[model samples]
Target: MHGFCMLNCFLSRPDEVTFTAQFDRPGNIGRVHIGKAEIEGYKSKVGSVITSRDFITNSKGGPTWRLKFEICTFPLKGKVRFAFSDSTADARDFDDAIITQQETVRATPEGHENMPENLNNLAIVLLQRFKRTGNLSDIDAAISAFKQAIHLTDEDGLFMPLYLNNLGNAFLARYDRTGDTNDIMASISAYRESKCFDHTSNPFYIQTAIFCYSRPATDYDGYPDDRLVAAQYWVGLSQQHDPSQVLAAYSTAISLVSQVASLSQTIQARYRSLLKVSRLSTSAATVALGLERIDLALEWLERGRGLVWNQLNDLRTPIQVMKPSGADYPPANITEELERVSKALDRAGASRELWLAPSAGTSFTDVRALPGFEGFLKPLIHADMIDHLPASGHVVIINVHEDRCDALALRRGVHELCRISLPDFSYTKAEGLRESLKLYLHASGARTRGDWNATRGMRREGGSGGVVKNILRDLWILVVKPILNPGLCGESKSLTLPEFAISSYIPTFQTLVDRVKKPRKVEPENAGIFMISQPGTPNQSPIPKPERNAAATVNRVINIMENYTCVHFACHANQNTSDALKSGFALYDGQLDLSSIIQKQLVGAELAFLSACQTSTGDESLAEEAVHLAAGMLAAGYRSVVATMWSIQDQYGPKVAEGFYASLIDSESEGLNADGASRALHYAIQNLRKSLGDSESSLVSWVPYVHFGV
Candidate 1:
C-alpha cells in the first residue's frame, strides 16, 4: 500500500472472493486484486476492482477511501495472493498497520490460535491513538477490544495477566475522561486479578505489576483503604532493584498515611493506623537522596514525621489571630462555624464515636474557603515549617533507613538546608543498639521502680555495661559527631547576651547603668513547681481531692496545673507498647495517661519536666510519631519539655533534676524562662557526665536526659 490501508478478506469457494480496503490520502484512488494461483515470487493473472470516486472525510478530519470488492476464481484450501495500490506515496501509519493485522486475523474462522494476542495489540494501539487524538470513541473501542481479548484468553495462559493489565489501563483512561466511578472500580478489579499470577521469576512482570498498582495508590480521590492496599502492593513489587519505583511507592504511601490517620479519627485510632506505616518517611527520604533529589527528601521527611503532633498543633492554632491581607478581623460567622465544628469533633473523639467526627470535620470546608483560611488544618509545606523555625540554633532531624542514614538541619537565618551524611550509622545498627539497651535495662533491674533493687548498685559492669558503653559511643561517633562537626555546622553561637563591661562608661553613667541593669532576686511566689505525690504513696494532695475516682483525680490535677507556669513529674512512667495512648506517668490515685493529658488542654503551660523513666521513649512500632508522655505534654500546650529517653539511676534522677532546675531558675531572673529549658538540660547533663567520670561507662546516666523544643 502506498498510503495507509487496511484489508480484510473472506473466501468460501474458488470462484468467489470478497475483501475491503481503506485509504487515508485525499483524492487517492486504490485497487484491490486477488489471485487463485499458488505463487511465490512469481506473477499471476488476477481479477481486480478499481476505486475512482471522491474520498469521504472520517471523524478524525482525515480523508478516507473505503471500498469493497469481489474477485473471481479465488481458490479455497490453497494459497491466495492480494495486492493494493494507491495514487499517493506516503508511508503507512504504524497504528494503521496494527489495525490491518488485527482485522486480518479476526476475519479468520472461530477458534483462531492468535486471536487474543492480536486483539490485545490492537487495543493498546487504539488506546495510544486515543491519548493523542482526545477521541472518546477510540478509548471506548479500546476498552471493548481489551475485554474481548481477555474473555478469549485462557485463564492459565501466560498472556492472560498482560491482557487484564491492558484492560485495567483502558478503564483508568476512560475514568479520567468520563469521571465514572464504575470505571475506577473496574480498573482496580482488573489490576487485582493481574496480580494473581506468579511473577517472581520475571522482572518485567513484576514491573508491570508495579505500574498497575501505582494508579490506585496515587489517586487522591480513591477509597483510602484501597489506595493503602495498592500502595502496599507497589511497595512489595518495587523492593527488588528499582530505586525509582521504591521512591515512588514510598511517596504515595507517605501521602496516604495522613488520610489513614486522619484528624477526623480519635487520637488512639490515629496512632493505631499510623503503626501500620511506620518509618515510611525515613525510607522515602533515603531513596530520594540516593536519586540526588535532596529537596524532595526533606519535603517527604517533614510531611510524614510527627503527624499527630502537627495535627494537634494545627487544631490549637487560634483562628482569630490569623489576619488576612486588608482584613482587620476574621468574619464572626466563620469563627462561630469553626468553634461549632471543633466542639462536635471533640465530643465525638471523647465518646469514641468513629462515625461522627468525619461529618463534623466536613463543616471545615466552608471555613477554609474564607480568606486567610485556605490552608486551615492542612499539612504544612516545607516553606511554612521553615518560617516557624526558631531565631537561633538549628533544628536537626536525623533519619535512619536501611539503605542509608543522614541528618537534615534547618538552621537560623538560612533558607537552604544543611545535609550531613552519616555513612557509618544504619537502621540495623540502631535496632541493635535499642535491643541491647533494652536487655541491659532488664538485666540491671531497672525496667521500672518496682523492678529496681537498691542492694544491686546501678553501675556499669562486665559485658552488659560494655554493651551500654558501646551503644552511646556509637551514637556519638556515627550519628551525633558527623552532624555536629565544625566543618558541617561551623561554630555554635550562644543565644543569650552577656553582661556589659562597667568600665566602658563614665563614672556617673556607670552608676546609673548599674542601677538599671541590677538583677532583682525572683520571689518564690512568682514562680514555683507543682509536684504530685509518688504513686502508691500516702502523701497529701497539693490540692483537695474531690473524690477517689480517676476522673476526679484528673480534674483536680487539671485545676492545679492551670494555676502554675510549670509542672514537674518525678515518678515512674509506663510505656504501653500495644497502645501508646495508655502510656503515662504513675500518679498517687491512678495513672495519668497521655489521653487524659491531651484532653485537658492546659492553658498558660510553659514547661513540663518529666523526670520519669522512659518519658520520651516511643513505641518502636510507631517510631515516626511522637506518641509518648513528653510529646503528650507538648501537645497539651507546654512550650518546652524535659524528658528522659530511658530509665535513670534512682539517685541520678534527683541530681539531674536539681542541676536542671538550678540553672533554669536564675537567682536574679524575674521568672522561669522556658526558653532556657534546653540550655538548662544541656548544662545538667554535662555536669552529670563529669560527675560520673565523663566516659562511655558513665553515659547511661547522662545520655538518657533529653530536651524537646525551645
Candidate 2:
C-alpha cells in the first residue's frame, strides 16, 4: 500500500539493434611488454601515433607496455581522451579507488592533455582499484553518476562505444558491490540502451549482462529467476540484433571456437542445450551415493556445462584451463558436447568465428592431446573473465530454492513422472515451491495461523491473522513467467504460459485493472439499512460502514446475491463455489466479534461471496449456525463462498479483484460467463473504474473492498 508505482517503460523500438566497431581488427593487445617489461615500437608501413603506458600511468617507472594506434589515413583530425569531461567530485576520490596489478605500477599521466581514452579507461581503472582494495563506496558513487557521463559523451560520436564500454564497467562494479537483487536487475536492464539508430556493436553491454547474470550469489533475492530472465533478455536481443556477435573472433583460435560454440548453444536452444547432462547426472550420482558435499564442485560443473551448452556451443576440446605449476587431470566432461548441441541453434545470420578475450594469464598449454583440431574457429581469453564462474558447472553449488521440490509428488503425479520420464533433469532440494505457487485447495488463499477473529455485525464472521501475500505473489510470478519468457520456461520445466496472469501484462499495459472500484459515496441516509436477529445496534446506525472511517457514502456497494446477475461480479468473486465468494471481508476496525447484521446478510444471500475470513464451522455448530462454512452459506441462500483460508492485504487485493472483474466482465459481455449478465444497473462490475475515481470521498473509506469470490 505504501510502495511507489514503478514507472512502466513505454518505448516502441523494434527489439533489436545493429553495431559497427571502430577498428578493423579490434582486440586485446595482451601483455606485450618485452624482457624488462618495456616494449618500444616505431611507425612502419602505417599512419599511426604511439602512446606509452608511462604517459598514461604517469609512472616514469622502470618500463611500460605501449600501443600503436593506426592514424586516420584520410585525416587524423581529432583526439580521443579516456578522461571523462564531467565529475563533480575531486580527483582524490579517483586516486582513492582500488586497483590491482600483478607487479610494478603503471605511471600516471600528470595532466588532462597527456591522457588518452580516459572515458574508456575510467571503468577499468576503478575496477583495478576495487580489485586491489575491495572498497565499494567509490565504485558505487561512480556507477550512480556515470550515467550522466554516458549520456553526455556517447551521442553519435565516432568513438562512443569506447566510452560506453567504460560506463558498462561502472555498472558491473556496482552490481558486484550490492548483490542487491533489484540492483542487478537494474544494471542489466539498460545493457542494450540505444544511443543512435546506427550500426554499432555494444559488446560491453552484452559482456556486462553475462557477468551479472551468470555467477550470482545465493542470498540475493530471486537470483536464479533474475539470472534466467537476464539470459533470455540478451539472447533475444543478440538474436534480434546480431546472433553471431561473440566476445571475440574465433576463426583462428580453437579454444575460442569452443567457447563461442558454448555461447551459441545457450542462445540457439533458448538456453536449453544441455551440454553436460551426463556430467551433471554423474555428479549428482556422487551425491546420491553419499559422497562428499559436492555443492561447490557441482556449482562449477553446472556453470561449466551452461557455458558450454548455453553460452558457448561452437568450439570443442577446451577454452582455457586451470593449472598450478605442474598438474595432471582428465579434461572436463561438460566441455565435450559443445559442437554437438550447437547444431540445434537457430542461425540468426551470425557467425561464431569472431570471438576475442585476453590471454587471462595462463602459464602453459596442454595442446599435446589434440591433432585433428583443424577447425577454422579462433578463441581468446580476457584477464578478467567475470571471475568465480570457475569454468565449473552450476549444479555443483546451485541453491536449493531455485530448483523445484517434491511438492509435485503430492496429489498430482506429474512431477513424479516428470523426473523418471525426463531423467536428464535433477531433483530439487528445496521445500515449498514458493507459497505463491501453493494453492489453498478449496480456498483462494491460506490462513496465516489456526486462530481467527470474528466481529459482530460484520460480513467476515471468521477472519484470521495469516499472511498470504507471498503465496499470491508466487502464484502471479509462476503464472506470468512463462508468458514473459517462453523460451526459458520451455527449457526449465513443462509449465504452459498463463495468458490470464494479470500482473505479467500490467506493467506493459497500465490498464491491467485489479479490483472493480466501488461506487461514489452518497448520504448513508439515502441507502437501505438492514438489521439481524430482530435486534442489532440499538439506533440502527450500521456499525460505521465495513470500510474505514465513520462517514462512508456507501453509494455503490455490492448487491444482495439475488440482487444482480453473476456476470456483474467479474473477478471480484472468488473462483470457489461459482466465484460469488464474500470471504475475507471484515471490519476495518480490527475487532474480533461476530456482527449479527453481517450474519443475517449471509443467511439471506444465495451465494456466499466471502472474500473475508476462514472459519469452516460456526460458534454453536457447523450446520446449525448461520455463519458455518459448508452448510450455513449453502443453507442461507448462497450457493458458495469465494473465501480466503487466510488474510490478504487490503492494499493490492482490491486492485487484483478489480482486474479479475474486468476480465470476467469483458468475457461475459462477449457471452463467456452467461450467469454474470444478471447484475442490475448501478452495482455492476462495469462501473468499478468509475466508482474508484469518485473524487467525492476521502481515500480511506473506499479502501476496504477486498473480496474472496470468483
Candidate 3:
C-alpha cells in the first residue's frame, strides 16, 4: 500500500496530484483511504480525490482496488496503481491500467442491404444505375440519400453544402428528364440555401449559382420576369465577393456566348442570346454611367468591345520585340519563346487565363519577364488611344445598346468629349446593316449581266446595294457627320456634305519591294543568314540547293518593315481564323503575319497598302472584334490603311496599287496628307469605276478594295 507506481497516460494532466481510490468487498464497495500521495519528481502536493464504486475484472477473478491521481508537472505523467484481492495466492496481470485516448468517429450512412454502406458511394451508384436503366426511381433514391447525408451533417460543416449541392443537381436532372417545374424550383432553392454554408472562397460555387439562375431565369424561353429577379440576385451574390471573381465570371459568360455565336457559322446567325448578353453589358454600363461612374463604364466596354484590342495588344508585344532586323537574327531561344507566346494567344479565345495578364491591368508582363524581353511592347489603356487622336480629325465611337445608342466623339486638341444621341441607330439596325452589306456584296458577286434574274431578285427599293448606301449614309449622318460638324462649338455649318480635304503636311516613307524568287546560290544552312542586297529587292542567299529547302529561312520583311514609313504588301495574303496572328502576307524567305505587323510599333508608318487578297476579312466568330489585317496595321500605328475585304482579281491589285501611289505622289496641290489617302482611294475607285463602265462587274472589281482609318 505504501509503494508507488509509474504510469504513462494519454491525458495531459497538471502536476498537482488528486488521488481517487476504489475498494471492493463481496457485500459492498467503498472508498479506500490513502496515507499520502506524492509525485516522484514534482514538488506540488496532491489535491482531493473522488473514488468510484468497486469494479471487478474476470482476469483477476477477484475484486480490485483502482486508484487515479494527477500531479502538477507539465509532462502530464504520474504514478498510480490498483491492488487486487488474492493477489499473492494466484498472481494475475491487470490490463485495464493503461488509459488511451479515443478518436471521434463520423457516422457513414448506408444504402439498403443489397447496396453500398457509404452514402456518397450509394448516391453515385444510384446515379449510374439511373443513367444505365433510364429509371427515374434510381435518381429519386440518390436524391433521398443526398438529403439524408445533408441532414446528418452539421449545418455549418463544409460537407453539408456539398451534400445539398449534389441533392440539387440530382433534382435538376430529374427536372430535365421529366419537365417538372417543381423539381427545377426545388433545385434552385436547394442551391440558394447551400450558398449560406459555403465559407470557402472557391469560385466554382459562384459559377454554379450563375448557371443555376441563368437557366430558368435569363436564358430560358418564356420564363417569367421573377426568374430574372432570381438571376440578378445570384449575380449580386457573386458581386459581393472580390471584383476579380466578378470580372472572371462575366468574361467567361461572354466567351461562352462567343463560342455559341461562332458555331452558328452562318452570317445570318444573329443569335439573340449573343446580342442579349452584349446588351446586358450595355445596361450594366448604363447604370454605372447614370451614377457618373465613367471608370466603370470604361471597364465594361473594355470587357466587351475592348476584348479584341487587349488580345491584339498582348499578341503584338512579343512580335515587335523579337522581330529580326537586317544583318540581325532572332536567336533560337527568342524564336522558341515567340512561337510559344504565339501558340498561347492562338488558343486565347478558349482560355480566359491567357486573356488576362498575370497581374491585373498589365498585358504580357509574364511574357515580357522572360529572358531577352527587355524591350517588349507595353500595354495601353483606352485613354491612351483617345489622347492619340488627330487634332483636326474626330474619333467617333458608335455605342449600340439595347434601348438606345450613343455616339462618343473626341478630338486631340479638344478638352471636352461629346456624346450624341442616335435614336435611329439600334443594335437591330447595326445587325441589319451588317447583314445587308454582306448580302448585297455576296449577291452582287454571284451574278453578271448574264444573270438578270439574280440581279432582279436583289433590286427591291431598299434592298440590294441600296442597303449598303443607306448604311454608309446613316453612319455618316448619325455617327460621323455630327462629330465633324462645328455646330457643337457654335460655328454655323451647312447640312451638305463637306468636301474631303487634308492638310499640306508631307510625310515621307521608304518604298520596299520584296518578292521571293530563286537565287543564284543557296545559303549555308548553319549561318543564320539575314541580309538584303538592296532596298525593296529580294534578299540574296548563298545556301546549297537541296539543303536550302531543308534550312529554316528567315523572313526579311519584318527586319526591314520598321525602318520605313509607308509600307505596301503586294504578296499573297492568307487569313487563318484558327490563328489570326498567323494571317499575313507571304514574304521573301518567310511569312509576315498580322502578329508581326501588330507587334511592330509603326509610329513611323503613315500609310499601309495591303495589296493582298482578303486583307480585311476578320474572323466571323470575332466579327465584333477588329481582328482584320487592315485593323492590325492601323493598330501597329498606321494612320491610314488601304485593304481589301475579299479576294480581288489578280490583275487588278497592281492597277490599284499604281493608282494609289500615283495619286499620293502626283497630288501635292491637293495638300495630300494622311487624310488625303482616303480621298485618293475614293478617286482611285472612281477611276476603276470609270474604267469598268459602271457595270455590276465593275462594282465587284472596285467594291472589294476599300479604305480604313484616318
TM per prediction: 0.62, 0.21, 0.48
lDDT (tens digit, per residue) of candidate 1 on 1-710: 32112211211131232222453332222222221111111122222212112112222232222211001111110112222111121123434434454554445446765567666766776786676667898899889889988888889988999998899999999898899999999999999999987447777776777888999898765556568889988887787656568877887887888777775556665776676677777777887777777777877876776777666544545342343322434666656555555544433254344334444465567667777678766655566656666555566677788888888877656888777889998889999988988888777665554323354655456655477767756776677667664564344332111111000111111111122232233344645667654644334212222123232255576668767768887666777765555777766666777766655555456778987777888777877676677776766666668887776666677778888889888534467646567777777777886678644447666677777645
Those runs of model 3 whose alpha carbons end farther than 4 Å from true positions after fitting are 1-285, 288-387, 439-466, 473-567, 570-574, 586-592, 596-606, 619-624, 635-639, 646-655, 667-676, 689-706
Q: Please write out the lDDT profile of model 3 over residues 275-371, one tens digit for every residue.
A: 3344545555554454454544544554555244444444444554455532244455545555555545434233332222212223345445656
Can you give the lDDT of residue 328 in candidate 1?
Answer: 34
Misplaced by over 4 Å in model 2 are 1-94, 98-116, 119-156, 161-194, 197-238, 241-432, 435-710
1-710 in candidate 2: lDDT tens per residue? 00001000100121221112332211111111110011111111011111222222232222322222211110111111101111223333335322211011233233322133332344455554564467786576455435534555536655555455555666666677667776566555444443333343687765665445333311122222233334444433443444353111111111221222233122222222222122332233232222232222222222322232122222211332212212333243323232232222212213342111111101112233434332212221211122212122110112122222111101121111111112222333112532322332124222331111122111121231122333333433443342243555554433422222211100000010111111122232332222111111223222212233321111223233223323111111111221112232222222212212132332123223333333332221111111223232332223223333333333333454445445445542332221231231113223443454422121111222222211
Which candidate would rank higher by lDDT, 1 or 3? 1
Runs in model 1 deviating more than 4 A are 1-154, 157-196, 200-211, 235-249, 318-329, 450-453, 463-465, 486-527, 538-553, 667-670, 695-697
Q: Considering summed lDDT, which 10 consecutive residues are worst modelled in model 1?
A: 498-507
What is the C-alpha local distance difference test score of each model? 0.60, 0.27, 0.47
**Cα RMSD (angstroms) for every candidate in the order listed:** 21.7, 26.9, 22.2
